[model samples]
Target: MKKIKVGIIFGGKSAEHEVSLQSAKNIVDAIDKDKYEVTLIGIDKQGSWHLNDQSSYLLNAENPKLIQLNKSNDNVAIIPGSENNQMIHASNGTGLDKLDVVFPIVHGTLGEDGSLQGMLRLANIPFVGPSVLSSAICMDKDIAKRLLQSAGIHVAKGLVYTSANKGTISYEKAAAKLGTPMFIKPANQGSSVGVSKVKTKKEFEQALALAFDYDNKVVVEESIIGREIECAVLGNENPKASLPGEILPQTEFYSYESKYIDEKGAELAIPADLPEDTTKQIQQVAIAAFETLQCEGLARVDFFLTEDGKIYVNEVNTLPGFTKISMYPKLWEISGLSYSDLISELLDLAMKRFEKNNRLKNTVWDD
Candidate 1:
């Protein structure tokens, strides 16, 4: 049987660039080589795409803080409308072998905000994760929360602010509305890249500055005093949710360091201890949020479960982290899917969606 040529695109001009490198390394190492041929496509912080040699695609692969894309001379560009679904050498216009599908691990900004997905769609390529619209929706916390709330799903009370209105809402005003110890984050970032927990007025101001540095818009959410629970959802039309998991953050909250740089920053409780009824509720809500956002392939739905049993939908990660320690894969692993098998299932879903879309009539006149 012919092996599928899978392109793993990672590293992007986002704050989560290092995190993407770590994820790509794990996928490259664990994917079934016998079933799929892997291609390493690395995008540097400067946004240059390179066809990297798999062995040396990432520099300082073990160190999260130091990990970066190892640039190569084989810079490449995607050929839109190409029948072969090929990427070409930017310099000589030489075409590389067609990729059966792409498993994009780019986590934030241009990578996750529908930019890369749109490019792949134009190139007529099958890529893992959500569609362009879903990607954009999920990446923006403000819009996602509003949509979830409109769907009868509970979301944290918050206000969205941009540079134009940044000075209008003072910390005192925010605290009066949402209470103290609010969570501030960039509207369009992931992996908690520019997230901060602030109680004092000074901290609130500082956090706003930091979050605004990452994106023009910022989200200020009331800190829900509840267990941080997460559910991994998989598949296309009929998606399944894994048993919920809980995060025990050693820090005040799960910061960027806690998530990636510091290994001991958080303890993950897989199959979180919850009532059978609560578990079922969480699973149902997870699937509902996934479908509500029009997410395809996979997503990790996060929630805040209060002591009184209230469940608030936090956000949905279209392409969650896939590192060895990441909750998305770990939850699936505990729920019966192996790491290698999860990758295969995701790729298969991508191809399935691609075929379904291609079958739809593009023109009124018959070819």
Candidate 2:
């Protein structure tokens, strides 16, 4: 049996670059060696793609023994178009490898926000995660909230502030509308990047400034006092939701440091203790949001479950973390999908979606 050539693409010009490296490393370590030939593509903070050997591709900061990128003939490039799907070394223009499918573990910004997806579409490669439209929409917090609300899902009431609104929008006015203790974050970032819990007028403005530093738009949502529960979703159509998990964060909220940098920052309670009815509602909502957003392959739906049992859709991560401690794979693991099995399923889904899409008429000439 021929092994599938899989391009494990990770690390990109994103605020979550290190997180991407960690997630990709975990995938590289967990992927079935007998069934797949893995080719590592590492994009640095400088936005250059490098071909990484297996050993270095698996190295991470947490690993006391770190293996840096092999730079001897490292620069890599991809030529768009189906016939030229090969990833080549820039120096000699040698075809380092061609990918049958790509597992994109790059989180945040250019990597997750449809830029990479668009490039993959142009390259005519089957890659895991949501489609370009879904990726773009989900990356923008304000847009995602609006779309989810339009789909009859409950999202926190919020206001979107852009650079144009800088002078006009006042912290007091925003606080009055959304109340104190609001959550401010970059509309286009992930992994809790640029996310802040604003408790006062002063903090609100400061957070908005910080958020604006990351993106032109920022989202400020009224605080929802509830347990942070998340559900892992899988498949392109007729997707399935795993048992819900709840976050027990040690910080003010799940900050960026808490999510990645710190090891004991948060604890995830898989199959979160909840009423059976409430669990069912969360599962249903997870699948509904996944389908409503037109998400393919996978997504992790986050929610706020109030003490009174009210549920509000927090957000949907198109490409959630896949590290050893990440919630996305952990939830599924508890729900009977091993980490390796989940990776296999995602790759299979990508191929299936690709084949179905190819069958569609690309031009009116086919008619």
Whole-model Cα lDDT per candidate? Answer: 0.93, 0.87
Q: Per-residue lDDT of 60-104 in model 1, one digit per residue for the tens?
A: 888888887899999999989998736998999989999999999
In model 2, how large is the Cα lDDT of residue 113?
92
Question: All candidates' TM-scores?
Answer: 0.99, 0.96
lDDT (Cα, tens digit) per residue for candidate 2, span 216-326 = 998889999999999999998779999999999988899777776676888878879988999999999999999888899999999999889888999999999987778
User: Top model by lDDT, which number?
Assistant: 1
RMSD per model, one decimal: 0.8, 1.9
Query: Which 10 successive residues of model 2 have the least lDDT summed?
Result: 64-73
Error of 1 at 179 (Å): 0.6
- Poorest 10 consecutive residues of model 1 by lDDT? 78-87
In model 1, what is the error at residue 66, expressed in angstroms? 1.2
lDDT of 1 at 250: 96
